[model samples]
Target chain A: MNIQNPEIENNVFDVRGLNLWYGNDQALKNINMQIEKNKITAIIGPSGCGKSTFIKTLNRMIENVPIVRTTGEILYHGNDIFDKSMRVEELRTKVGMVFQKPNPFPKSIFENVVYGPKIHGIKDKKLLMEIAEASLKSAALWDEVKDRLNDNAYGLSGGQQQRLCIARCIAVQPDVILMDEPTSALDPIATLKVEELMDSLKQEYTIAIVTHSMQQAARISDKTAFFLMGDLIEYDKTEAIFSNPRDKRTEDYITGRFG
Target chain B: MSAAKLEFLREGREDTMLETDQTHAFERYKVKIDSGRIERRVRLNNGLKHLFSLSTVFALVVLAILLYRIGVQSAGWLDLQFLTSNLSRFADKAGIYGAILGTVYLMLIVVPVTLILGVSTAIYLEEYAAKGRIQRFIKVNISNLASVPSVIFGLLGLAVFGRMLNLGSSILAGGLTMSLLVLPTVVVASQEAIKAVPGFLREASYGMGADKWTTIRKVVLPVALPGILTGSILAMSRAIGETAPLVVLGIPTLILKIPDSVMDDFTALPIQIYYWTLDTVLTPEYANLAAATIVVLLAVLFILNSVAIIIRNKFQKRF
Candidate 1:
């Protein structure tokens, strides 16, 4: 079910001159990139390189911190998301986020999947059930967990928990999904499963993922962006960036000369 | 090698003699057993010191004796009829029914109101309020209130709700006073329970796009409920046994009928016992009645504590 419509707008998020500061410490500086619609964009960087911070800023989740401040524009479908007219709650619904660790709510698996829809006022049980089944199937967990949906979510394995979290995000029907090192906490087998899920998910939703694994970024992303010291060093096609990067720093990092 | 050995040096023999002399001196000391006996004596002395450290056991024995005395004195009067019948003017006919009714009525009012107010205040402080001087002040004041004597609270209730507001000397006034006296304890306990809920649940709820109040209502409260209920039950038990506050609020000492309204005069079990004990001509019969009331109060407290323990155990199992 590849839903990549090439005629659709290529740039879903157009970030320009974006800068972020946490009190006296500057975390992001002059980050400019174009995130394509219905494509997976992976941000790869070393530790403390602000990849997570940059993705968090896309949905204004970083602004919840008291000392965080941002300058510049993040145009989501040609509208500035940071504009005063923008409702944060609405923006959050449109741009959902999944954390690094698998954090399913301490509830039944069915309840965990349907929590987002219920909060958005989807009261009809049939509709909620349909959405939950669709989401679980999309995350590649329906066949395994469909029969025991009433069981506690914590009873699932680490990979299943991560997939459940993904299902929860998909249930909200968000336009974009932001993942912060979604597979970093999983085993190789679980990581492979998540990578496969990401490949299928990009057909329906734009994804911005921050990962420390360069191999994972190259394997799953259509486009790849490299960040260092809070700066977007290079943004290009994943194969091109890995094989023959234009930037000397990007080449050095990919070739393992220095982080 | 044989030729070299044949030329044994005189210096070597002198060194061997010196080594043999040192060995002989070491053997002389090694044969002695006096130091071994000294070590054994030291160990015995330490063992005797440890054997005398039984003060805790003695203290426990004294406590058991005191409890036995109270239990023995109160055992004869604890009859079923003494609990079911109403208080009579004559000492022989007196029963704890009026006091029991009053206590029940007081609990009916105090339990629900205090639970709601206490849990809400705790949730607000734990979940919604921003960290600042005002929140800190409120927290400190609540801690102080929990320690304030119940008699002082009774005085406050008398002035504020009884005389000035003219609620009159009724069960309503007494219940409200006791509620205020126990509110701080409930809040503190509930706050601790709310705090025990993991931070990840809150983040998970917020991540789901639920509003703050909705998150609290659906996630935080349910997870913290067992702890909150435990605290509320303990607080209610404390409220039930309170005598001074009711005394100050003028809880009637002798009433034949159950309270019909909040404004009606009522006699709690503690007040009834106090009245019987203080009668100028206190008889064995009256003492027996007081003892029976005491036994009933203890039973109620035990039941409430057990309920709290059961709830806590259930929550532990789930977690």
Candidate 2:
């Protein structure tokens, strides 16, 4: 059964009966959800609950696992992402990802931010610099790294590096960004910075984040999805899910009764 | 301490232990040190350190003695005239000009061929190939080929490049044979270098919508280049100094003309040293000529290795 928000007919993704497996072990089971456009969707679950796997499926990056097998459909902007006619590169151009660890390339900060634009054939140095400036400002990292654009990215602190990764994603001009526990490795202050950055990012990009922290979901996300044992048990407005969950499992989980 | 104190320390603040029991606990808790065991361990550690240093010194001394002997033998014989002149029947007029040129020409072929073939093979195995029985079989055979005798490679090269291809003992044939001899080492080293590239970098590149080739070219190759270069240089050095493979390939020991092209007949430094050392019985000065040739070969290898180290350092700092 797919859950669609009747009031908001505009959806960015419509997943229908999606199931995934790694070799013989099932990782995601029959998930159906409609992600609305330009909204912050937070997927929170215990470890190994397949929230990460579900987000990776949106861009088809899970295919890199070599043993991953999926059945059903994921429609991105009305195109079946698994269709043979749909190019993976084209799909990924419209979608970007941020990993749990702050993975800035070993290149200079300017180079790291411009990697995507350069690969997409943007050769004009002036244009690349403009894009870099705009993306860094959007990611809220311009003030910290503006003076040292040529320094190696590894020189940045952990919080700044993660922001740089977000800036890197923004330079691609993607419509959606998938984050796999992007703030799990940061301290409380750094986590707060990223959360604030995410609040402003939703104005331009649709975001789907998988987080381990329930409080982070309540604080920043508009839609909340609680997954348990490879199944998406609840998906609704954050207030509804937090205050008046319809499912007993969702109520128990949010109350810290059992995972 | 006393049994009660010991229990208190072990389990943290036993409820029944009062402050009055602490008055006599100091005497009971007096420590006993094992000075004899400590002394024995310290002595053994120092003795082993001295023994290891002595072994290192012994090796260096032997190397120094050998270098001194070669230097003494080649001092008067090695000169600019000796380096410029060609081979002759008399020991006083002999030179290794042809052999030096031949060795340099041989490297021109081996370096490019081995690098292209070895790195390509390694990339195919590490990145493109599927993991299964067929890939495993190919990997096992490549490693096994590394341990096979270099002379065996010479025989294969002789049959394929010399007889079947009709290249004969030309520098082309000898260079191809030497490349085959060192191909396994290059392949193994390149594979290790490519395998050492971290997975996260590849993931990050792909996440940006870059395809496999772009990711490999931009991320993987730059990271693996230093290791691959170092390995290839060491392999080339081995090829430059090898005698058994050239011997099996029927390379000429003495030639009057320097090889201007790969198709021309040639003689290498190791082959010249072998022939001169064999002729030492008839002319004792031929021994000095062989020693002089050995010194030249060592100098060439040293220069090649120094370049490799410099390049490796330059690339290693980028990451």
Steric collisions counted per model: 0, 0
**lDDT of each residue in B1-319, candidate 2, tens digit only:** 5797678778887554565466457546554346887799999999999999999999999989988999999999999877877899999999988888888899999999999999999999999999789988998898898888888988988899989999998899999999988898999999998988888788888898999888888888988989999999989999999988788889876688878989999999999999999999999999999999999999989998998899778777433
* lDDT tens per residue, model 1, B252-308: 656777778888888997888788877736565676677667778878998999999
- What TM-score does each of the candidates earn? 0.86, 0.90
- lDDT scores for all predictions? 0.86, 0.90
- Best-fitting candidate, scored by TM-score: 2
lDDT of 1 by residue, A2-109 (tens): 123355368888888898999989999988888899899999888888999999888887865768989999989989999999987788788888889898878999
Stretches > 4 Å off in candidate 1? A1-8, A257-259, B1-63, B317-319
Question: Model 2 has how many clashing residue pairs?
Answer: 0
Which segments of candidate 2 are over 4 A away from where they belong? A7-9, B1-55, B310-319
